[model samples]
Target: MEEKYFTPEEKKEMLALSRQLLAHTREIQERDDFKRIRHIISDGIKQNHYRRDRYGINPTIHNLNTAMLLCDKISPDRNMIIAILLFNLCKTEFIPTEELVKEWGDDIAKLIRGLLKVSTLYSKQAAVESDNFRKLLLTFAEDIRVIIIMIVDRLALMRTINHHPNEKMVHDVAYESNYLYAPLAHRLGLYAIKSELEDLSLKYTNRKTYTDIAHKLNETKVKRDQYIAEFIKPIREKLDATGLKYEIKGRTKSIYSIWNKLKKQKNDIDHIYDLFAIRIIIDTTTEKEKSDCWLAYSVITDMYQPNPSRMKDWLSIPKSNGYESLHITVYGPGDRWVEVQIRTKRMDLIAEKGLAAHWKYKGIKSEGDLDTWMNNVRDILEAAETGPMELMKNMKMDIYDKEVFVFTPKGDLYKLPLGASLLDFAFHIHSKLGMTCTGGKVNGKNQKLNYKLKSGDTVEILTSTAQAPKLDWLAFVVTSKARNKIRQTVHEMNNRSATLGKELLERRFKNRKIELNESSLMKVIKKLGYKTVTDFYDAIADESLDINNVITEYEGLDKKIPDAAEIRSAEEFQLMTAADDDSTSSDVLVIGDDIKGINYRLSKCCNPIYGDDVFGFISAEGVIKIHRHDCPNATNIREKYPYRLITTRWSGKLGQQFGATLRIVGNDDLGIVTSITSIINKERDTSLRSISIDSNDGIFQGFLVVGVNDTVALNNLIKKLKTVKGVKDVQRSK
Candidate 1:
């Protein structure tokens, strides 16, 4: 309940711990580099403290102290203790890893590297949470001690969380503690640390739940203590008679756990029977360890009637986290159900301290237990999308989830995340089986691919060669393996389709006269607005494009007209005669495929401007005639002579003269024609070739023929012509 600063008690303990650490390790005080290593870490800590404060960062002195104390508590390994001392300093970049490794050795250096990775795993990033978590979860491969150190570090920080000033920081820390760290701790069999971390996290993340449970527990502490004393009296008497060296303790449910049950069962604290459990820890040698637990279990059951359904014999098969115990519920005084746990002292120690203790008291069975535990953790991470948000979003389902053991057709059991689907099961077997599986029978009844599987169901996957992965399969499948395999299959299928389509296009182009370049073809494809070659080719293969027509679209691109009436491909016509910098030879701008070595004349019927939409036709005079698309004779000409219709547009530059006629309407006023003529003459590049006017009944109408360089110049002239006295409108005549 104190704001854990550098109190005298902590200082004394720190002095004692430092002395004990120096006395124990051959790598540190017993070596030539002891003073140097100590100086480096000590100096780094001071500088880091100053740096954090200088940058308006929360000083982590208390956090460092807490971590150091925790390291000593978890293990007396000097490498770890010194690593803890310098971990924060290195994380904050006040000191580098080279300094530690150079002075101390590789053992310390390796642990520091693992600590650095642990720092990165929780650093804020743009990536989703699961990605960071996936890498973090795999840190066991780096050094088993890294995770042990990390778990202890997290426990230390949670214990001193009130020191953090930022509300968001506190929330993030607490959230990760509850959802990630505590679950990890529980998995490692660090029951005490796990429970405390949960309670601390709930205190910050959900204060109301934490406070309510703590308040209720506190108010009834006297009555609960008395009940525990009374309940253990008979058990203690029986255990003493058996001459088993042991310790009996009463364990209460953590506030967070209690709060969870309260919300789940909707029960008051008083109604929550078995809110605490009695743990019987007996001492035994290695040979009699299993027998001792059974002996203790019998003693407790003899004093009470055991519930047959509420018994768990984990002593026979220890938990994956190296937890070995016999758990049972028995009716106590006044018919109240009380849970009990019996374990050997070594088992109890491992249960209390988790992986660190297990490593200290090394056992062959513990090694196997850890292998199984770590394999499960790795499997969950490997099979799932381990993005930051992905893992964080489904932490409840992945990290703290209850496991379901389903049987394959061969009766072999496979553990899956709760709510795993049938498709997930198939993918778990093999990617190919998953892709080709159509459906499966769950417990002899047919079920869909997305059916949520339950424990003990015997699944028989039905597969067919015709069955292939679909795009929609990603929506229903949750496992990363299934989703990624589906994506890979889709990609391969698309590539095959695109290859075929590209081949068909190349052959089609070969049948035509013109050559096709992949670059030019791709340019045209993109200009048509397709995102990728895959989409374009998929369309081609699916009949969305007429391959023949598309191939011909590019043919005759550079055609030349030799005879008057000779016609080429009715495709885009390009006026390639115009030079890039010099457009004086052409009056009209042309846009389309190249129509080089051809002379074209403007048609008299439509008098199209430089920017007007036009088409070309080979005339009888050995020249191409260009006409506006909306010309009076355009429809009749195109419908009667479809092959003669060629798509084209004018491509003219500034200072190139083009001809257009304008019509004007105005009020009949004196000097109106003269005023319009003056305005047109004022334009920079204007030639008023001719003008005609008629005035009657106070209204005037005029027609003017003009030549200008381009649409910009012509538009400028028309705008000035509209400003003439009494003028109503001026428009280019078609």
Candidate 2:
């Protein structure tokens, strides 16, 4: 035995908790190999210097000790121990994977990879925990040991959380442990480990609730122990009289569990059942274990009035995760209901350690059934899901699904979650069958589409060529397969509608002598207040896009292309509205240095030049607009406008010129503004026309402008600018 692996101080720290593991390992493991592995692990930890720190590795030792404590009176392999000690190492990249592979062989390396894969994915998978968990489980699907190690690894880390300083880490770990890890453990049949996780998680997540329930359990410990003794006395004597070797122990429910009981019972902690159950562990061989479990159950029920409704015989057919026990609730001492679980020692081992014990040691169900389950799970995972959250939701629905096995009329069995209806069943058979499904017959009786299937029912689906799925099927269908098929059908229908709509829109565009691209149509659709391009298309397909209305909208947008007058109107209208104002008249043609300090300028609207008749309008917004006499908004200003109009003109030769941008789009080329600049610069005393070029792939848009005599000169400049080589078009910028 590798007793020397633990020093005296180390023994004092962890010996008591690990004694059971040590004993089990000593019994099952090859002596020299266990000795060498333990020595190597200890030496490796001591010799190597870790260059990283996050969660302390000191707690890792505590976690391993805690894992050993929960791993029950059975051995975990070198992979489990090596992986646990090194799981935190994976996050920091402190150890190279190839080095571990060289030192520890492929199994240990693979196990470590699985653990670290989860550690790396932990943060990224929060939004998709259920699916991520499924992926994680599948990552280690080939090696059952990897999952067992992870469950234990989590157990270790969770036990050491309180020692850490990060409250947020503690809370997050506790939540994931409770909501995801603990349930996973339960599903894996590690009830003992599951209980601990739940209790510890609640301890951190809801300390007050955990504390109150724990305190209450402690207060009634003696009485609870006494009651368990009295309750099990009769069963113990009965088993002994029959000469069946068995060890009976009373089990107290965990705090979180008791809290759940309290909530379920709608009563105080004191009113809840203190001694949750009595476990009868029988000594037997694997061959006779099932019979012995039943015999034990028979003995217990003979002595006490059994609750027929509470009998759960998983012994005949163990859980998918290899959990087997026969439980019965009977009225015990003082008329209190006590639950009793009867199982052979072999079953007890499996129930305690989960699939690890079975897969490594027992080989009870080494292949067929578990493979089928995992294959089904993989199929479910591989199916297409649309939104990000849907993957997790559907994965959770599968992971937490309570399966019910039903038979086809031909005697082949199919598994579906409980509460799955006929529609889901038909879809489960085949998508074509589901799409054409008219109804079904359950066990020789006709059933509706919504009829909930039960176990052992032989379902026969009836299909018709004319039948098709309705949108309302989404309301009743449960499985993702049916939902997916239905959604695909709806999408196909939408595609057909879109095709019709596109054709109709194209015809309308052709009739109007308009070129309508998708981009242009989308712009027009949005301008007409349609929510989506699809909505616009659907309206067209349904004849909702009336020809007159479509023409009106398209023409409105086409007319909005800013010529000089429309540009003037849009600029003035888009500005802040004028308030009440009174101002003195000024000459149309005079320049004075004294007027430079005033808050007024030639408006961008009319751009009144030196020779044009101009008028100044005072604005309460602390600005003034100088407009031409024939400005677009002149009639509105003269007749009905509120702001005071100050008649004025460019009285003198004002050489000052403001800037404007002309947007010129073209294919990428060098010196695109050569001819455009020649025209503007050829004029006498021409102001600088600055150009800024933006190039994307083979396309370029240039913004350039110069001093203009009036709108006519700007117009001529734009026309001549468009005639330049490589220049596709020209437009004025706002």
Candidate 3:
């Protein structure tokens, strides 16, 4: 295939635009900061390969253009702005560079860094730690400018998405933008960027659906455009006659947005009406903003019947992202419901830029507000150490939840996530307040912390130094902050309990004169297959592993127990031993004369070490038939001849190898199979007969039939396997 490059005509347009942007930037480059920025951009362009390919021979050309555009948007010094844009592009492309001097010289550069830190890098696979990584990045972004740069990057990418070749890449980027970027944009009040990102992302992630919708819209383009133009003409004329400065524009919904509507509503493309909408931008003083919008709404309603429920009064209380507009669904020509948005130009700008606009226009005067909010999210993550699923769940509910505007007792307004309880409100005040939370009053009425707060509700959290967090608090708390705190407390309690268990074991061992070292008791415990001393102690404490039993076995008690001959005949011994339980013995009747003692030991094939049920039957050669309690053949034989039933009981000392089977089932995860094998190797001196594991449909099922000392050893081994991460269940065969 021939390599594709920009067409000559396209190159000409790019160069022309680049020169214009450069000229605009130079107009404001007289300042010292601008001179430094120009130097950096010039140096950066020369060093960056991608920049050279994208811009002209002079890399400064594109850098200059980006600078000029950004400067025009926010009146930052031209040089400083260019330097920042250059840094952003260079870092994003991974260009090598020496450390930067003059740390705070360019505010724009600082913002770019912040944005880069939070922006998701393109990856072929979904990241396992993507969510936690994002949260960590956000924690480090002290400046809101970072958020602006991120939005700008997304907008730029959308504007130039045609350059990318891979459809999957496009789809991935779109999916990310829609799920992460768009929501972020909405949160930050960048309505324009948010909507555009959503549309662009939707276009790629669902191209087929997007194409179908676009095709339908195009088929009706002429009629739709004519209706929209005619519909807006009367309103425009009326507004013009009133001497109100207003601009009217008709817009087709982004392909993605239309496609989404179709999918969500399960309707055909033709049924989607919000697709063709009109935006009315007005120039008004802040004081007359509401009045102007209301007037426009009246004009629109007079021309078309309005859908009462479809009207959104964002003008009274703007969205959390700082979007302010009056939206109305009006019945237009052909009985089509067309949506209209009325907003001032200032509102439009803020809506487009989001938090960046806020920083630029309003400045970060309230330094504590953003930091406090971020700290709350961090606290929740810390508490969620018990499990990733819990952390993700609580963080989604609390940190990324929709906002509800609430008030303090003194009447200061605060915004919190929806479904926030009084505890969340208390934590929002202070961690101490949350820890000591008792009950609270909402809107001057006494209420529990579990009270579901609504928008515009005044909340006063009651606290006491005597009170502290309880396990029950997790039930009602919605935010990560509260849940994390609760988890932290619980984790501490568990650690303390484990510590106490360890102390108890150490003290007991010391009293017995058993030195706790890497060898001797410790080594033996590890050899027997425990991960850590703490785990051993925990097992002992839980009675899963009896320390006394282990000690008794270790001390060599074989001499104290009677031999197998004293309990049963050689034939009987063979049958009872097959079950691997020393506590049981079986009686067998020899049909032949008693042969002189030919010493016989329990067969190791089925060690029948201890606690196993067994039976014996006479064989053709007068040898005893040994079988396990539930063995198929043994059950049949016992049923056929009721008088042939043999009694068996285990009565053997410890430290004897017995063959046994274990079955494990669990959710498969990395290193889990290895962990199981490791546990078996460590717990007992044993050899696996044949181990097999089959994983399908996210579940892992496996069996390990191995040789071990006794039933206690097998039980201990099973306990150890259960502790391996992601091992859901472990059971021994009867």
**Index of the highest-TM-score prediction:** 1
Candidate 2 local lDDT, residue 102: 82
How far off is residue 109 in model 2, in Å?
2.8
Model 1 lDDT, residue 304, Cα: 89
Judged by TM-score relative to the true structure, which candidate is superior, 1 or 3?
Answer: 1
Candidate-wise lDDT, in order? 0.64, 0.61, 0.57
RMSD of each: 19.5, 21.3, 22.4
Per-residue lDDT of candidate 3, residues 214-243 (tens digit): 788789899887888888777878888778
Candidate 2 off by > 4 Å: 1-52, 55-76, 86-91, 128-135, 140-142, 187-189, 232-250, 273-275, 278-332, 339-734
Estimated TM-score per prediction?
0.44, 0.41, 0.40
- lDDT winner: 1
C-alpha lDDT (0 to 100) for residue 204 of candidate 1 = 89
The C-alpha stretches of model 3 lying farther than 4 A from their native spots are 1-18, 26-80, 88-99, 103-109, 112-116, 119-137, 206-222, 225-252, 276-333, 337-734
Which whole-number lDDT from 0 to 100 does residue 465 have in model 2?
A: 43
Query: What is the overall TM-score of model 2 with all chains considered together?
Result: 0.41
